[model samples]
Target: MSSRFKMSDLGLLCFYLGIEVQQGHDGIKLLQSAYARKILERAGMGSCNPCHTPMEHRLKLSKASTTAPVDATKYRGLVGCLRYLVHTRPNISFAIGYVSRFMEQPIVEHLNAVKRILRYIAGTLDYGCHYKHGG
Candidate 1:
């Protein structure tokens, strides 16, 4: 397209929408360390220590138990935002999908679960999907 029309070369892509894009010898890697940090700071949990896992495997979420309700819009928004992230973040897909099931009427417990995910992100800022060049 650049040959057809007059356009400036921008060089290699580095960042887009807070996501870091880097080309390596093997392939290209997509990461969102900046976005993860912003999420921690926005939630005022930046100082909180990181955890190995987002949530325990035994953590069970049931619709029967109605713990105090929180902001539906905010919770849903978070879930929706995370969904976009799952494109290059398959590791968190299971957890995020589980929590998203209750977006319509999220409770305090559900909110806490979401916070845990943020905490997990803090620890795994370097985590991302890597695609090989020849793959």
Candidate 2:
């Protein structure tokens, strides 16, 4: 593909798509901080207070809730973005999964739960995994 398209060398990769890559002697580090931040901005929570945890412990969302329903499209979009972040943020996997269950019929409660995850992401933007050089 490179030969056919006459692609030029771009040197080391720093950012790709939404993931940031850092190469070093020990290993490679991947991060999606920018994408996470974008998600918040899209949700209009760029300057929101960060949360210590993505979700409350043992928190449960109901499908048959009495609370007012929120916008399904917006809720799904946020949840989908969070799911993409799971590639590098396993910490929020459970919480994202829990909130995702209400995507079809998200309520204010579910939206709040998802917002908590976003707030948690805001606090941990620089957090990412470092893979050691493998043999």
Candidate 3:
């Protein structure tokens, strides 16, 4: 492939984009712990207490929420970062999607929901996808 394309041989993949890679005799693993941490720190929740779940049960969010509005730009940024984190953290995908609906006019309630996701990530940052080697 190098003969056909101009690309530098960076050696075995360790990190690409925001995902971390680990290769071993058993298999390969894809992780985004660092990226996740960055998101939490950027949102000023780096030291937030961890939660067992990303969201509360029976969570009901709406475009016409009655709560006061928060900074749309900041809310969007957090939701966007959380979305990218879904690549290796499917567990939080649904919660992120739920909160994303209010990106245009996020309220304190919506932001609180996003915070829960960050807390959950803090507790499970090491979680990731693993691919086993075939026999």
Cα lDDT tens digits for candidate 1, 1-135: 978999998899999876799887999999987777766776777878888897878999976675799999988877776777776678999999999999888899898998888878788988998989876
TM-score of 3: 0.91
Clashes per model (N, Cα, C within 3 A): 0, 0, 0
- Model 2 bad stretches (over 4 Å): 1-7
Q: Give Cα distance to truth, residue 11, candidate 1, Å.
A: 0.6
User: What tens-digit string does per-residue lDDT give for candidate 3 at 1-135?
Assistant: 989999997789999998999999999999999999899899998998999999999998887867899999999998999999999988888999899888888899999999989999999999998999995
| Residue pair clashes in candidate 3 | none
The candidate with the higher TM-score, 1 or 2, is 2
Deviation in angstroms for 82 in model 3?
Answer: 0.6
RMSD (Cα, Å) for all candidates, in order, is 1.7, 2.0, 1.8
Indicate the residue-level lDDT of 17 in model 3: 95
TM, every model:
0.88, 0.91, 0.91
Ranking the candidates on lDDT from highest down gives 3, 2, 1
| Model 3: CA > 4 A from native | 1-8
Per-residue lDDT of model 2, residues 27-51, tens digit only: 9999999999899999999999998
